[model samples]
Target: MFASVFVVILGLLYCRKGSSQSFLGRPRLYGPSEALAKEVVYFKCEVPDYAGDEEIYLQLFKVGDRNRSLGGYTSLRGEVGAIPKVIKPSHEGYLECVVSAQNNSGITPTVSHPHYLKVIDPVKGAEIIHSDPMEFYEGNALQLQCQLSAGTHVSYKWLLNGQPVSQSPVHYAADNLLRIDRTSSKDSGSYMCMATNTFNKTTVFSSNSSEVVVTIKDFVSSPNIAFTVLKEDSQNYSAVVTCESTRGTPPITFSLYNRTELVTNMTTDDRQATFKVPLVLDRHLGWLQCQANNGERIAYSDWLPLEVVPAGGPVTMHYDFDLGENYAIVGLRFYCKVKKGSHLRYQWFLNKTLLQDRGSFYYVANEAPKQSILLLSVGRSSTGTYHCEVSDSFDNTTAISSKKHYLDKDVLNRLPILLVAVVFGCFTALILLVSICCCIGVMFRRRQYGEKSLLNLEMDTMRAAYEGDLDLSVYNEDPDVVNAARGDEFDHASEASVDE
Candidate 1:
């Protein structure tokens, strides 16, 4: 009888269900399998036969610890419903899932899959707004498509200043007319949009667009300085004249002429603009005129005097800064860049390299990236070499440049001062050259006199220094000089030194 009973017990144990049991439904706990515990997390569970009218039960247990089960706690007990409830997790650990079928055979509870939950800090709210095409050309009517792409249902608010611009003169709501009727230059300024969500709120505004000068008779102020290509076929030669104007009601119109023909005519809503004249011979080098009118007043720019550069000189680059303007804000800004070319497509270079500028200045205008403009907003980092280069299939040349180092120590207010310094520096250098030539003539005279005076090795080196040849190419083999020029230091000196 004992043997039979033992064998029967073994057979019963062998008949136990598979180790992994699939619980179709019976309300599983909200375990993300691994989720942010304690966060208002949504959980759902499904049972196989707990159909409509039949209710299943749920219980909670902390796995591995000696603890009583929280039975039938009533988290969610609907037969037909998928158990989905948002519950905050109590602790950071593995949550054991114990489930059982209700309204049935009262089967023993089966353990469900184990899941680990983690709790973390909450996220900040969103009321941050960033929009492209922030500063539009004035006078065309504003179309600001405002939207808060993020935040916790942040409330939206738009303001032109401290005043609530909730309505427009032409519309019932301030949101419409992104339009300004008879737009004028005085209307330009910063536009700020605000959005606030539940968690956090912040604001961003476009840089002041006061520079967005608009004319009632014309449009937004265009680049006053412009250029033309006269006698485009001339042998890589051209004449240039800088344009300037003193008075006018903006929306002023000016045309560029190639002798008797016009190449480009531009209008402005503000004070100044530049025009470029193509490289040409004598006939094409006529007066370069800029005319400004806004229906109320007729103003003309002084006829720019022309200079024809010699063909043999390399294409030169130049730059200028308009610091006298009181309205200017940033210290480092590009005011103007003039480019001259015969063959190469024009491209601007910063620090001797090409760059498609993406800066505050770009936000101010819609001109082509290929065309350069004046920049303001100067900083320490803004100091560098800027130039324009044009090239052809055969050769490329840098035609214009404006360097930051052109001024004297005290007269650093403008580049023209620095340019004068460079000229004086060069002139000084030329005089030194002449003196050296005279010395060489004297040396020949001394040699003819049959006495070696002062052309010794040291003297030769000193002469080289005065000539700006800073090379340390020394021959220690000279019996007269060694200790002062030997070993590792001498080797380094010779290798790193420049001859000029």
Candidate 2:
């Protein structure tokens, strides 16, 4: 009979182990699977279908020390199965529970499966660490580390510009570190790190570090210089020199040098800087140079020589015209320049009268310090003599004027006198020719009709006075020739009358 009872008990135990559902008197433990270090956690062990008067005890122990209870609860009627525990680093292991009851079953104990209890230290004072002088050059490596003052089982993630850093081949994140193998100008902005740890599968604690500013700069190329010369007087000059780089970052330092001696230096957020230099005659200015730097490298521009030229020389003037399809002048321009001068002033004149700069009719175009151009739209009003006067800025006493240029040879003032003189000369010559012809006619008449009588001349003179077509007053200087012609006419008339 005892053997049969023992076999029955063993069969009952085997059946309970094989079933998917827990037996009626078995205990089930429920609580948080993980807790922070030094935190309080509660564990509840419930036994289904227990009587009120039964005495129950809930025992907690580590999985490896199941024979000894670390802490327990004792109560009658199985009503005090709720247990409290303080989690510590020493308690970081699998935990288990056993519930024993004294009732009709007489001190039967049910053991639960192991529950993993992860003990973690809460995160505090999270921060991001990087090298000093948070400036980097393009194509260089950058490293960042996320750290916490006290934490366990922590995870790290990187953020840029308040957003998650996108995954790329150049970006790496592992352990507590983030690395960028290749950096570019686009990588410049605010950077931060996030530290997190899982309390349980459903709960997480996180802390964010303060943002850090990172700047990426590009290497500067070779520098270049541009300069302009302005003459202040005959012996003094000034120049404006500009230094620039085509491709580089800002906050660049530009240095100007005269040979090996530094003239001046300037710092600006732009890529270009300007400087002023003075030049004096009879004094050496030295070779000019420009240099650029941005904390990474230095670059230099080509050297330039500084020389001062005096503002005096011979002044000359010339003209150019544009013609239309019909060969008519449409536009005219007069250019006046000095052969060699530095700071010369120019003035234009028309017909010895100073010309004012007026639009379209007359104006000055491209009026440089040493050269000037007078532009005119071809018209009757613009037709006149024009000239230019050039002088230095030292004093108004010394000056030079160009030769005269005339649009018309006979100006308005000389036209009438030339016309009257030509007319009077022609009139006098015509009267002389008439007098000479008369003299020859009279000599010819005297030689042919020398025997003619004075009585025939008196009769013809009376008849010619009656004929109005012949005016005998014109030959008053030679009275004999007039009388000879009249006598011939009278003889002809007398012979005709006789023949009739």
Candidate 3:
């Protein structure tokens, strides 16, 4: 009996000791619900019977990853802390903190609820979006939208001229869009959109700024057009017409018209346009005008008249020479007539030598299509066969006088002595008087030559009335000399017959 009681007492004592060792509560881990990368996080393990000298350890595990811990198991005290500096976006998964407390009696381990850590990156490529009609008038409504290429959750603020925009009843912001009820000239300035979010807590991302310009315009008015003659000639003509509206909205259309037919059309956003007519003919001659339209109003310019003359026509030439009947001693003149031709060239020749108007002895007195006069001061050197040669520069045709006329100084010298002697004898006087009378006779002869020279000038004036069928040559030799010689033979025969 004594031995059985001693064994019972020992078994009871062993049971009590084992129950005291197992009396510690389960270990509990305490930490923040969320953490950021590279931030220090502290975790604590609690035991109902924890001792200051107990061995405690901490470990972090990523949720859904059973193969490894975020940070390898770390030996620590009851309270432990860690800094995950090299954490990446892949480390943004759920995180769990496990803590174990151990003493000489037993070990107690506990795990914390899954915690989420956010790894953020900055927002990039911010932008703005809007519609056309970039230019607006006062009292118009406007809307603008701002967006970002990155970041899901973002807050937007409007800025004007790099300053926070003041909110008014007419101007306000809606999420990422800015709206204006009635814009005014004060609203004309640069606008920017700034975006901020949790991902970029310390930094703000901004979109490229946009500009708004407002104006007040007047009613459309008549457009002014200026006409410029670029090139013009008998065959072809060219001109440019420019039109502008100074007081109207842009996108103006201009139309150029010749008479009633449209020649060309152009449209421009700058409220001005130019029309060019490069090559126009005689048929295109008429009144021209331009019209401008600005969608709301139409205006017309003053009429501009264009005239073109036709070129090229038939060519004809008529000419004659004047040698007085008595004696062309003073001077001689030649006349040429051209009709039904344009761009005609006249050439005069004396004995087949080209006569130039530069010299004083032979010069062109008057040059015209109806009549051209070549006056030659009479002298021994002036005696030459003269003829006119004409050319039609338009058709490149040439014509010469048909009949050749002759002038001989010898003929006048042979017949002039008898008349002079008879006139001088009728005025008989003393020897000295006779000498004076001879001098007077010489003066009279010179006056006669002067009168004969005027006769040739008169003939030149009358040449225009000469019939075209009459062949008259104003050339090198006189045909009348042969006729006069033949007449002398006839005169001799007639005198002999009378004597017989």
Residues 117-160 of candidate 1 have per-residue lDDT tens digits of 54322222322233324333334454443443222222444455
**Number of the top lDDT candidate:** 2
TM-score of 1: 0.23
Model 1: runs farther than 4 Å from truth?
1-38, 41-55, 58-139, 161-163, 171-187, 198-291, 294-500
Check candidate 3 and list the clashing pairs. Answer: 385-476, 386-474, 403-473, 406-477, 406-478
On residues 1-500, what C-alpha lDDT tens digit does candidate 3 reach at each position?
A: 99999999999988966664554444444555443344555544344444455565556777777577666344434444452435554666577766554443344455666666665433556677778465655567878888766543457878776777778899889778898888765676677877765632554444443544334333345777765544444554466778777765666788888879999988887777888776453444678787887665578888876643222343333333346656445566667655433334567777887888746577875464444577766667666676766554332234534234444556534556888788677666466787998999999999999999999998986785684555566554667987898999999999999999
Ranking by lDDT: 2, 3, 1
TM-score of each: 0.23, 0.44, 0.30
Off by over 4 Å in 2: 1-26, 32-39, 47-57, 61-70, 74-80, 87-95, 99-110, 114-123, 131-142, 150-221, 245-253, 257-287, 294-296, 303-500
Q: Write down the lDDT of every candidate, Cα atoms only.
A: 0.45, 0.78, 0.62
- lDDT score, candidate 2: 0.78
Q: TM-score: which is higher, 1 or 3?
A: 3
